[model samples]
Target chain A: MAYSNKARDFFSNELKNINTAGTFKEERYIESPQGANINVEFPVGAKPKEVLNFCANNYLGLSSHPEVIEAAHQGLNERGYGMSSVRFICGTQDIHKELETKLTKFLGTEDTILFPSCMDANAGVFDVVLDKEDAMISDRLVHASIVDGMRLCKAQLYNYKHSNMDHLEEKLKETQNLRLRMIITDGVFSMDGDIAKLDEICDLAEKYDAMVMVDDSHATGFMGKNGRGTHEHCGVIGRIDIITTTLGKALGGASGGCVSGRKEIVDLCRQRARPYLFSNTMPPVIVAAANKVIDLISKTTDRRDKLEKNTKYFRDKMTAAGFDIREGVHPIVPIMLYNAKLAQDMARDLYEEGIYVIGFSFPVVPKGQARIRVQVSAAHEKEHLDKAIAAFTKIGAKYQILGKKKDEIIAQYGY
Target chain B: MSDDLKKLIIDYVKKEYLDDDSEEIDESTQLISSGIVDSFSMVALKTFLEKKFQISIPDEKATTEAFDSVNNMINLLKEFNVA
Candidate 1:
């Protein structure tokens, strides 16, 4: 039987509006692997132009690494491409188990269970661990996946302010009567490029007798001295009870996720998580590629350190050019534009200037908080960073967003 | 309890996510259907309800039907006999 026309009409109308709005962005096909410089193919016989790629999550520049590619090829040849089955149903390969074991060891956890995607990992979490007798306390600014996951749980829920340990403490006191409590948060916020206060959170978790969970999707491979994410960054490596992260971003740019934690918790999630039980296991190529990426990241501080230097250089240069950059060490840098229209206009102008950056506003963020989200990578060279800064300065001056050169502002303020 | 819950939720929204001059929220207005509450906010709302009404909200009951409007949330509370 055909589906109902009512839903189809509504969905089609919405999709059309999205296309009409700049927000309904279609993908710009790339002919190259993700890196600092890549070629995007336009329709027709249009020449594929090289552009500075600034909006990728390839923090370590390992997405197209030769070793990682070789590993993927070897896996494809030896194990075939995919398992048409879920993990528990004859899909558990030795390679999968090896990857899980490596991830657990890397994150300093007792065990880990893999899922097809991080979104599924988050969506499948709450339903498994939480019940009517439980309490789920989460940060107000957590990822969308965490929110969805919590919705599927039968637990009393509470949200403290973003990284506000004091508010978390109060909430803990408020929910002290609940049977059990679980605290969930993002290790690093993706939008604002801010690191979560995990130290304070862990302290509160101990005082309140609650378990802590963090989604380290953004922080996993680029944060901390050893790239162990927020826990390592905050010196609480073994304090967090559960950690979930993705292989889609820094790990390999392929797709996979895992819930890492105490053996019992991981075992329980493996058994009960709807996405883990229902969805097909990750392909062998993806698993192998991710395993290689992790090994590269762990073996040397080279990739993460290079990313840190690039991030600092970009942040300093952009700020020096009189642009309003979000203050942080996180790789994500938001060049604030105040008005939504201005941000959109700036992004368009930058793209025309051969720099690829994404403008976000209103629905994605707050209305007045419009900006272009620039993600710097270790793959980026000095030339690429300098080019981006120059382009921003030119367009920013054209739009009067460049308030003053850093020296001028500081001097004028009588510093 | 109803008045207090209304004030707490609205105040939290104004202080946390929205502008201080946010549009006045009527208890009967739709939150989810009207797009005021996104998927992320839905989980936050569950926590909000649990803290405010002292009731346990099952995953099966935490749907758009229960959180669509103030009236729906109030009705859900009544169904659970938590109000």
Candidate 2:
């Protein structure tokens, strides 16, 4: 088969434009497992260096936890490797049902259904439940998966300004005549570390006779007091109609997600959702590991508490050092740089100093909101945080990003 | 009224899309093609224009052809007799 010139030209031109725009995403090879410290190889064949990682989604530090590893190994030995079929056919296992039930209990939902990834779970939701007569009012800054999912549905879509309850209310009022109205938003926005006003949203939903959905990916394993998510944090756990979350982040840092909601919704998704109906079920090892993660978190609050402490300490230290940290209790802390090139430069400098972080600009966030999104995890100890702060102070002074003088920063932060 | 509408659109685009007042914007600048305004922002722009100008922009007319550039948006408003 030969390639068409039109297709070749279109792709090549697009790649060229991406490169020129400085938005070309390049992958860095990680030579070790995900954790607080990992070896990263920049260029192929180059020596990998162990850098303190601050960009991973390992909020609970279970990605490389000994118990998670042991559980995975045991699962692989007992359940074998892969389930060759989709869930309805032959892939449903005892562990899968156990994990789903555990998730339902944890999330305070009536039932749960697993997907290979949260993206898939999101992709499968709207089309199955909503139709042309229904209306979906989404947050403007909801995750990309939600946008893509909405595109597949026949529902009349309306987007309100990010986290603006007034705008949401206006949209809801406009959509009053629709057969079904649903409001969707991320529980904790990954970019700015801001939690959505779920309490207010629930109130509005009740007034507008609408249902509410939340994607709790960023808040799943370590957000609330018991780690139920933003709904629990906002005291709207049972009030929210639907909740979707991931095991790929704080759960075990592996790949799996679930939509936990009304039993009827889960039943319909199992019957009609394209992703769940067509895609293979989650592997036994991931299912077993996720189950172990839920069990561990259920038993004790050690990891979540550590993560909270780490987040507060890092956020406080960074802010007191004259860094403009986004105000949030979430583990994700965005250090605002405002300049795209400067953010890239700062991230590179931080990486060179053996502190691994990534800069997000443009398409990831709004323009002029370029930032280095630092994610704190329980794996990071006092020494790790101190080292990262010292490195940031040094680089901040070099780049003149610190609001005050170097002496002032040191004097204020005790760095 | 037309000039005011253009200024309003340009100012909103500058503040929301470009996010930099220092960048120059012209009537013929390619907003969608150049990635200055994305799909989400396009919807937002449509909603803003509809509310501000008191014109209903149907779903079919909310494409790059109708709203990609300032001149195109003005022409779209003119079609609705709101420009």
Candidate 3:
């Protein structure tokens, strides 16, 4: 059968254009599972093996943790491999309930619902809760998943400037007559690593009678005293109405997510969210492993302590080397490179120095604000961090970007 | 071209995609190719168009080519008696 021109055009010209733009990213396959340092096989022409792994979501050195692996193995033996159904269907295992219950206790919430991935947790949220009479006011710099979820709902949407409480309050006032109002923000923004103003957002939520939701994907496993999330970092854990976070980032670096909050809201999400209703339940092994992760995280503070120290060490050293770094309390450290080509070039050179980092550019972030987002981890020792810093300083001098700042540019413009 | 319909489409696109005002969107611009329309945007547009035009865009016509450019989208809407 002949395909439609639409399909032909999509597969031919448009797809070709997108791929040709140097933006079509292909994943580098890792022979081993994710960890602090992983070995990835390169393409035919390039070197066979590249060392140094600075690009991963495994913040606590727990992706390959021995206990987590054993727990996963035990679950596989007990519960089998796959669930083959959604959570409401024949997929709710004992481990799933255990994980959900533990998550509720860990987050200090009324209840929790698990999704197969954090992306789905984000994509499924708004459709379930927000109606035509509702409003969702969000931050300008929240994750892509939150934005996607908000689009799926019938709620009136407004975006305030990032972390700007005044704009958020104004939006809250504008939408006060709506049946429901929610102010959504990221606990720790992934790109720039900036922490959100959750305390202020919660105060405004109380003042305006609006509910607050925080996507704590980046903050969940390491931010608070017990790694509860950004709300814990801000000392307002129970004040926020809803918390959506990923198990994928720091909670063992596996793939899972949960929405924890008031039981009514979670129950509604379970009933209506399309991704949740349609997607298969998480596998038994993954669930068991994640359950153990929740258990481990609640009991220990070692990983969080290590990550905090590494972050401070790297941030301090990078600043001393005269690099303009984005200010934040998270492991996501953005080293700003204003030009797109410069960012790409710097990433390439960094890799040549046996350090792995990715360049963030336009479409992913605002234009003229591209950077190398170096993620610190509990796995990184002092030697690893110092070596990475030396590599950065060397490349910075080579690229003539060592001492350039916004002030320097303004002075050059004679402003 | 009724101003209301044009404004409705534009408003839907602007709000749903979280588009900034500086990104020069025009009727001839391709929403998908220009990165204004991703998977979730596609889902939202599908739902919105179904309600607005009172006709369903068949699965065959739901590819990026049909919804890419605003002109192309308008043409598809014409099939559903939009204009």
Best by DockQ: 1
The lDDT per prediction is 0.84, 0.89, 0.82
Q: Each prediction's Cα RMSD?
A: 5.2, 4.6, 5.8
Please give the lDDT score at residue A253 for candidate 3.
82
Question: Per-residue error at A156 for model 3, in Å?
Answer: 1.0
Q: Backbone collision count in every prediction?
A: 1, 0, 0
Candidate 2 regions exceeding 4 Å error are A4-6, A404-415, B1-37, B44-62, B77-83
Q: Give the TM-score of candidate 3.
A: 0.83
Residue-wise C-alpha lDDT for candidate 3, range A98-150, written one tens digit per residue: 99999999998999999888789889888788888998888877888898788
- Writing each residue's lDDT as its tens digit, candidate 2 over A139-171 gives 888999998999899897787777877778988
Q: Give the backbone clash total of model 3.
A: 0
| Local accuracy of candidate 1 as per-residue lDDT tens digits, A131-222 | 99989888877888888898788787777767777678988998898888999999999889998898998998899999999999999987
- Model 1 clash pairs are A157-B47
Off by over 4 Å in 3: A4-9, A44-47, A407-415, B1-83
Mark the 10 consecutive residues where model 3 chain A has the least summed lDDT. A406-415
lDDT of 1 at A343: 78
True interface contacts retained by model 3: 0.06
Q: Flag regions of model 1 displaced more than 4 Å.
A: A1-8, A17-22, A42-46, A404-415, B1-83
